[model samples]
Target: MPAIPPRFSVTPEEIDRVVATFYASVREHPGLGPVFAAHVKDWPAHEVKIAAFWRNAILYERGYDGNPMAVHQEAGNVRPGMFDPWLGLFDSVLRHELAPETAAQWSALAHRIGRGLRYGLVEAATLPGGIPKLV
Candidate 1:
């Protein structure tokens, strides 16, 4: 049996470059920087982990092993509203770091994932009986 190939025409090195560049922007983003800063003390380690996650997601690699939804829920500070700015920043970085076609592909994937994460955060924060809290 042959192994599955990567979904997109991007290399591991490209993934690393994009991840590094995106997170550097993230660290300086007014809306996102503080949120990430509160949790990620080691930027380099976080970038490596996130790059592994993208590799797993896009390249069919088995290097990442973590639940993003669970981690966000556990953080208790990740808001649903943050997804927009986060995705916007991510799209910009993708556009700047990769070829236009590759950037579009990655952006589409990221937006889909972001929507799931945003929905999860919203559901996690809602009150019982399908009601959202007023707070």
Candidate 2:
């Protein structure tokens, strides 16, 4: 059987670049910086892990082995409102680091995943009566 090719035009090196650049911007972002800083003590390791995740997502590799939704839910500080700013920053990084068509493709995939993650967070935080949890 033949191996499946990467889904898009991005390379592993490009994924690394995008992950590094995006996280750098995230570390400086007023809305996101503190949240990440609270959890990620080693930026290099986090970037490598995230790069592997992107590789797994876009390239169909098996390098990443974590559940983003579960991690975010367990974090207790990852709010649904944070997805907008996070996606915005990620889109900007994709646009700046990749070709126009590639960026669009990746952004579409990212937005879909972000929406799912945000929905999961919201659903997990809601009460049985459809009301949001105050805590």
Please give the clash total of every predicted structure, in order. 0, 0
- lDDT per residue as tens, model 1, 1-135: 898988899999999999999998998998899999999999999999999999999998999999999999899788999999999999998989999999999999999999999999888879989788666
Candidate 1: segments with Cα more than 4 A from true spot: 128-130
- Evaluated against the true structure, the overall lDDT of model 2 is 0.94
TM-score of every candidate relative to the true structure: 0.95, 0.97
Residue 66 of model 1, lDDT score: 96
Model 2, residue 74: what's the lDDT?
93
Each candidate: RMSD? 1.2, 0.8
lDDT of 2 by residue, 18-105 (tens): 9999999999999999999999999999999999999999998899989999999999899999999999999999989899999999
User: Which 10 residues in a row give candidate 1 its minimum summed lDDT?
Assistant: 126-135
Candidate 2 Cα outliers beyond 4 Å, as residue runs: none
Best by TM-score: 2
